[model samples]
Target: MGLLAFKDAVHLVSRTGLGAEWDMIKQLEGRSQEDAVNWVLHSAASGLRPTPRMTPWLKLEPMRLNDMKTRNSAWSISQREGKLLQAWWVEQMLATHTPFIERMTLFWHNHFTSSIQKTLQPSLLYQQNLLLRRHATGNFAELLRAMARDPAMLVYLDGYQNTKSQPNENFARELLELFTIGRGQYRESDVKAAAKAFTGWGVDNNTGKFIIRPEEHASDSVTFLGKTGRFTGDDIIKILLEHPRTAERLTEKFWLEFVSNRPDPALVSVWAQQLRKSHYDIQRFMRTLLTSEPFWALQNRGTLVKSPVELVIGTLRTLPYPRESTQELLNLCRLLGQELFDPPNVKGWSGGEHWISTQTLLVRNAYLSKLSRGDLNDKSAAGVKLPNASEEQLVEWLLPVKPLQPLPTTPGARRLVRSLLLDPAFQVS
Candidate 1:
């Protein structure tokens, strides 16, 4: 059995979920590594909950010079709905017993990225998020298939514009380049063929669901990836899954997200083989990964830079804070460059070193300071007294990772906690 030491448990929880809060660590303290890994995975499977329904935006007719007011009102409502969706997911992350699901949902969000910025439809975005959560730990092939037909994706990637006459290559190119296989594995011809395959796939604006117009579909056979057939979008997805490079690409991504940003070719090949053998079963892959020796290696600890979502949600969940401050937290995340449902680009947020800069780091530190001062516009910390703890205890409680500098000899526990949070080590997972 792999040693499930206290530090190892901390590392597991940190990488698997948001960050290892003290209470959660205590729960897993003496458990075997397998038990802990199973608990996290099973908890995610069982604790899965639907995202709260988004309030639909006002339906406005086609805009004209006279309909400027209506257009403005509709735009305002869309923004509000987007903010609500972002806050709702953040709340779920805070309250979830199984945070791995949320974390994986996040990973898939970045993986199969579709932004509300371009789609301009918050309701469809929420639906897509729900789809991701439902299949977060399920089969990768199934998720890819569903995403190809997702309304938000259709809008974001211009799949709705694709037809037999004019096949838009946006979704097709991303399907191969960004989603399934890595770049340089496929040719431009493959992209064109895939676009033809997905023609006539679109969303119904009135109902916000995927629709296929048979007349618009390209019925003619199209060659793709060394195969020629009258393949529809579904067939294209199946073919992509059959490619060995798809498994390798997904394995490398998972390693980067959960293991390390830096690639280890040999280790990646081992996991890639397992992923293919399991037919892209995420639960099995996660179990193997969390319990593996390389996962617990000393050099790997605190190596990942926490994304804005992880940093915000992890801090709120760990500290004594009110649930009502979720909106402010969401706004903070937006400033930190990770507004949910509005990824910066089709490629999504480039995590790791890209998540940090001098400006963002200062903002993070300031937010931690605000939390310490009980100034987050909430009552949870108003009357509650902070424990009269020493520097070491405070550091251990707040940050599971090792600190870069000694805890300052601050007078109050809250100040010390803030300082620890601002530490360089705390910036990493």
Candidate 2:
């Protein structure tokens, strides 16, 4: 266990918050652990300010079902939305005083993975981003139900076009296989039956809402897991939520995603018990995980490889850089393998050690150099300077990592700067 002091508390805060700066940590100095924890909780909640969403300049404002076969330029629209999505996340990471909420937002983002690359429409992807962020700290049941009907999810999972006669097993398969249950927990027969039960469950053309036509549904009562009944999608979700496997599966996921890839059985089991006790109260579960004795175990620190979004957003937040031009910055994020809301596949990014590579390291170096130098230059360029970036120097910006100092500069100061630019700890946030 780590020392429960202002310094240790600050380390905990950095892990939970948007990889916060030491100045913020110093400001939080001398407070009780409860006070610090409450500070983050209260701060995250208060920071969420509702902003009006911008309507995209859609050339095909009213899309036709007939043109679905020959859709084009939707790609551009999706990319445009991608740009806005990054800006919004950067804004959230920078402005939010609390780290738990942002951490939760990232947790939810990976859990409910829908890529705009597949969706082909920014409007739907953008809507889902807000949905995850807004409900990041809310009830899990409500969020799950809402996401089941969300357009982005529907399209990404092929749930939108599901029909009775020709049922799409895509959504039902993933519903149990990926989202709720880990692999092999549910039998193949269960997936087939679930797909049949989910037949005709789809969204409408104009207004994106759940609509199940009675004729379209496979009304034949099917047996799922030895239970015979007419199971709708909602019923399936309810049953899944009730399953012991769901809790265990989610527990494993929480361990891998938040605490450590190599989980401590005692800690995870305790968390599972507490999560069940709280009736799936996510906020409570997170609090349990974040502040636990095992959580601050020295081995667990820096164990998680930062996701692309974590690295980019966390850096931007630490510097609190001015966003004069976002196009290039977003493009750089794309180079780093995290184009906002655009995962490589339904399974999402593999994430652990895959985040590091020679090429990606170079890209990371270039990005940090951009931050340290305040360069917005390109082949054909216009420079943008951030006023605050000057005051928030590089070494201080790096305090979230241990050592509280830059890498050794004795060999070569310039090379030290370069290594600092590409440091492995920069990957974690």
State which candidate has the highest lDDT.
Answer: 1
> Candidate 1: minimum summed lDDT over ten consecutive residues — where?
57-66
| Number of backbone collisions per candidate | 0, 1
Best by TM-score: 1
Q: Give a tens-digit lDDT track for model 1, residues 263-364.
A: 788878888888988899998998888887778777776778889888888877666644337778888898888988888999999888999999899888
The runs of at least 3 residues in candidate 2 whose Cα sits more than 4 Å from the true structure, single-residue gaps closed, are 1-6, 44-64, 67-70, 320-324, 374-422
| lDDT (Cα atoms) of all candidates against the true structure | 0.80, 0.67
* TM-score, structure 1 vs. true: 0.90
Model 2 whole-model lDDT (C-alpha atoms): 0.67
The window of 10 residues in a row where model 2 has the poorest summed lDDT is 378-387
